[model samples]
Target: MSPTNNKKAMCRYAGAQNQNVQRTALPEIIDRIVNSLDDPECFAHIGEEPIHFSTSVREMIEKFRNILFPGYFSDAKIDSVNVSYHMGQEITRLYDILSRQIIHVLRHDCLRYDRECSECERRGNEAAFCVIEQIPVLRQKLAADVRAAYDGDPAAKSHDEIIFSYPGLYAITVHRIANILHQRSIPKLPRIMSELAHSLTGIDIHPGATIGERFVIDHGTGIVIGETSVIGDNVRIYQNVTIGALSLPKDAGEKLRWAKRHPTIEDDVIIYSGATVLGGDTVIGARSVVGGNVWLTRSIPADTKIFMEEPRLIIKNQPKETDSEGN
Candidate 1:
């Protein structure tokens, strides 16, 4: 087509349509969509607050990080002089946001049973205080994690480098904070905390996982620790490692919800990149090394090394094809 005709064709498609069609069709579409939500399968409720408010949860995590690592991941200026003052302020702010979120989760659970909870506010306060009390312990655990990362990785320069720039450290820190609330059986908020870390770092550690001190995830990404997983001290895991469930029980009752489904890693083990260790019965014993891309489903004794054999590769050059006439 000619340039003039193409421009004319484009101009013909550039204007607004009929007002009556949009005005009539939009409300009808909305009504159809909204009315459809009344079906039994659809889950829109008429009167209820959110199960968990994500904005509040995010704020709680932010303040938690700020407290866990002062002057790192925080907006406030910190020094030895005013450390106590800043810590108090950050904890107060975090408690306010977290308590409200705990209350929201409690109310949501009560809503499912069509009951109004009078104790939600009190319980929320108690839960928040429990987590607040764990801050010092979480810091202690996180310091071990930071030290592990700095000591394990040859590329690490300083403690400040590991604290400020490592994704693994950040995810582990989030998990430590979330694990405290998870252990307290405060519903919904723990998962939210872990998920926020998953969004930022590609590490998917369940809040229910029991991880010990001096843990390091080197160049961490695609690492999944299942809900019932247990990891012992001085363990180091590389990127793309999955310590997950082999199979979930079928037709199991609610009693089996918290049953162990993931593997256990003992102390001083090193899991290299792209390794998958599955099944709750499977254990990596102390001082073991699992090499890259190894798929394991069975337990190994202590002081073992697992690696794949070297595969042979052939080198070949592409042959240029001649034209149809053999030119």
Candidate 2:
């Protein structure tokens, strides 16, 4: 054979061997990944129907928002003439989504925790019904919150403006809904709802917190209300406020589960920006004013004003510059 033909034949043989190696390596890589799924802590739901987190759960939240604030969200035009009909459709849709998601979470929890089955389907439907029935009451409470926001913040033009534009109000609205499910002892769904709001609003309010009506959160960026915080009616809080537990150990989550690890704010209290009130025993009495940048770990009497002393201001004047022609 010619040298060129011999070289071509050798190249074709080498290429075929490389192709075989590539095909063999692909399955080995896949096998490694598949083997990792056998680990006890991998949490792989192999052969099980997976829970829908992003799609169905988020859509359910949107439906609740549409129902809670009629016409404020992306819903068909709602007016007094056809209000009942529109609400019926919205509630029906919300119930369908809510019940299904609840059942998924409940069933997943039962299987994961090795707990006995408790008729997740029936419980889910009942929970959905209870949440739907609370709509009227929730609306009334939200109205008070809107009114408080308008009355407290001079920048608010109208209730409509707050409903449409305010991130604080939106966060509070979602918290109210999630808190209901949290109170009812539903599994997983409440935290998902609250985390969704936290992601969007930068306001991390745990659904387990008990907040009252006429609550107002102004410039609500960086607000963190812990799980056991008890906020009273007519309370107003500003940005960067932390109503949370003190520092905890690594095992605190297990030890402090169901324990009151946050402060209590009595009615008509105002917590200003950058304030940190820590410890479960800490309480801010009724009508107390917590000034900005103040850190408190103790209980205060009613109508008290807690403020950090004015930061010392030192204004140093700069000497005037001289021209090259020495002025």
Candidate 3:
């Protein structure tokens, strides 16, 4: 073939390749992807619909914390002089926000549709009013948490340090708030609050777990307290401790379903790091000390120290078999 004919064929081939490349270019693909953004609601709405409601609830938490701790949290300037005024303002604002968010969360998550009668809205409004009334109780619980942190951690300089610096205190604070909400039967808000704390502090405490006053958790990473797990007053636990379940429930078909399975920790019990107490039937008696890395399933008596000792091994030498009358 002639060089001119070959060159012409090559040019045609290059032009065809260029057209094909343009057909599937990055910009065109990006335009197709960008088309989904045209609907604002499609881009805006994701996850559960109550997320915005949850955000409002969290804002109330922030305001409550600001009011309770004053100088430790919130951007507002709080000193001895303006503390009362600032607290009052924050509390009032928090009450309003809490009423709205709590009602929304309760309607979306808790209130059984079957139980709703003609006076359902009135009952809900009354419940919301009761929740607002309970804010002082929540504040008292938070104060107790701060006191617990201060008493428990030697490294904590003051109550302010516990409020500002300790993640455990933060987690406990959230847990206390969630616990109150859970007790009020406010549904998904408590779990959401607990999960929010878990995400931030690495402490997964179920809101349904009944924890008494002065409960202290130190260096509280990877700590999990299961639902129905009752923690007594002045109970102290370290990092990497799990109070979980031993056995789950089985269905009629004998299929195991994840159910309430964690243990109950009695008062004055100190669980060291890496200790796991499993099963609802298992109980750690009062004033007992559970050592680090110990796995406990059974109930311990009061004032007992639970620990594991290293097992001793004895090596035995077996006698050699004699071949046909000691060869």
lDDT on C-alpha atoms for all candidate structures: 0.88, 0.91, 0.79
Question: Residue 262 deviation, candidate 2, in Å?
Answer: 0.7
| Runs off by more than 4 Å, candidate 2 | 1-27
Candidate 1 per-residue lDDT over residues 1-327, each given as its tens digit:
999999987776653345555776898899999889889977776677666657777777788889888888877678999988988888898889888888888888887767867488899999899989888888899998998898878899999999888999989988988888888888878899899899999999999999999999998889999999999999999999999988655765575677888999999999999999998899999999999999999999999999988679999999989999997
lDDT, residue 37, candidate 1? 88
Best by lDDT: 2
- TM-score of each candidate? 0.89, 0.89, 0.73
Q: Indicate whether candidate 1 or candidate 2 has the larger lDDT.
A: 2
lDDT agreement of model 2 with the native? 0.91
Rate residue 168 of model 2 by lDDT. 93
Q: Which of 2 and 3 is ahead in TM-score? A: 2
How well is each residue in 170-232 modelled by candidate 3, as lDDT tens digits? 888788777777777775778988888898899999998989888888999999998889999
- Model 3 — which ten-residue stretch has the worst lDDT? 111-120
**Candidate 2, residues 1-327: lDDT per residue as tens digits?**
999999999999999999999998998899999999999887787655477676676788788778878888864777899998988888899999988888888888887777898799999999989998999999999999999999999999999999988989988988999998998899889998888889989999999999999999999999999999999999999999999999999989789897999999999999999999999999999999999999999999999999999999999999999999988
